[model samples]
Target: MLEEIESSAHSSGVISMDNATRYLRPTGIDPIMGKVLNWLPKLGISIAGSRLLAVRGRKSGQWRTTMVNVLTAADGTRYLVAPRGHTQWVRNLRAAGEGELRLGRRTEHFTATELADADRVPLLRLYLEKWGWEVGRFFDGITKDATDAELAAVAPGFPVFRLA
Candidate 1:
């Protein structure tokens, strides 16, 4: 079944099933920590640049929210990377193409463009460098110190979106 999906994806020039399914490494969610993370942002405190990301669900059309680290490049571009790889938010954002990032009472809505795998290397390195302490475990041992080739090799497994 997965093979059929992969074959169809390749033929259609869409993301492959293997690329979508192979890299999802979900760590157990600590309920206490989850509550804290979600609560802090509502009180106007961001944990190391975390934001409450709210993207509309593709199937349900309901808004789904999660805590995420937003990375800002030196040139001032902002990005969102899925360290867990092709997550639900990634799929939702891919379908909706836009979402909101909430910090306190501020909700900034933006459209996102998914970066090609080739363009993800530097962003991945920068993201790891910034939020690695929190998200590093999801990267399969890849770190900010990884070589460009190493980062590139694992880029497809991670989905990066450039926000505008």
Candidate 2:
């Protein structure tokens, strides 16, 4: 009984260590999952996947990178929409009005736009339907069929930057 208990403890310790890597590794997904995420954008897909964006800080003027969801517009332009109302990246873009999106190996310039609420109503509805739970609780009380006035109220906070 004593020998069996010692063996179980040793095996459990190894399992725990292996589990730690699951959280520590950034590309923790298997090759298949990684491939799926990489190809998602090519298929004209918007699968709630985010990429690291490097933008000049508003005050500091230093390079800052943060993960953001990618949203494509009708005119073949890509945008970074901030649904959270107030985030550091949104604030940075509002101040600097320019940034670069780092998607995998490519980086693209983008011009910021603090869209009016009425202007973003349609986009917001699409976001809620497509992004689903990935957008967090930001739009909880905000109705999908919000009026122009309601959209404008929230528009200042949810800025959209067009890729240049």
Candidate 3:
């Protein structure tokens, strides 16, 4: 199943690896590759917390599980960000506008809201601060203090979800 999705992305000509050099992620923080690399803990520690977000396919209505880095704010808002614009998980969230997240065996429903220009900046900043050093060119020209307009132009497809 995973291979198929990876294959499809390549076949569609939407996959780009040029940005990798500009961004840095500790070894496997790139979701563009696969979840196993980004999630599985090492030495009894996981650098980025992991979560399984389950959402129904927009076209098929079938539920799917995607491993993602979980980000939480001091204000109690939780978001799942896709630095890579061309990810299946991001697509699913957009198509459904709603999904459930699983941490271990616990599940919580969430409303998937596409973060506008105003929201992308902060989210991108958070992502960069956390994994940017590991990712390099992937985030070239992206700064922790980018304005909403800048984010909207650079990360047109990135989305931020609000937990319900």
Candidate No. with top TM-score: 1
How do all models score by TM-score? 0.84, 0.60, 0.65
Q: Which stretches of candidate 3 lie over 4 Å from their true place?
A: 1-47, 134-137, 145-152
TM-score attained by model 3: 0.65
Candidate 3 contains a number of clashing pairs equal to 14
Give the Cα error of residue 27 in candidate 1, in Å: 4.0
- Model 1: per-residue lDDT, tens digit, 54-144? 9999999999988889999999999999886787899999999999999889999999999999999999999998988888876768999
lDDT of 2: 0.60
Tens digits of per-residue lDDT, candidate 3, 48-153, equal: 7766668898788899776667777768777777755546666778788889866654667888676665566777778777767654345556766677677656
Expressed as tens digits, the lDDT of each residue in 45-126 for candidate 2 is 4345566666788899998776668776677666676765455676688788888766656667777776654577667666
lDDT against the true structure, each candidate: 0.85, 0.60, 0.62
Alpha-carbon shift of residue 70 in model 1 (angstroms): 0.6
Ranking according to lDDT, highest score first: 1, 3, 2
| Residue 147 error, candidate 1, Å | 1.1
**Residue 164, candidate 3: C-alpha displacement in angstroms:** 2.7
Backbone clashes per model, in order? 0, 2, 14
RMSD in Å for model 1: 6.2
Could you tell me how far off, in angstroms, the CA of residue 118 lies in candidate 2 after the best superposition?
A: 1.8
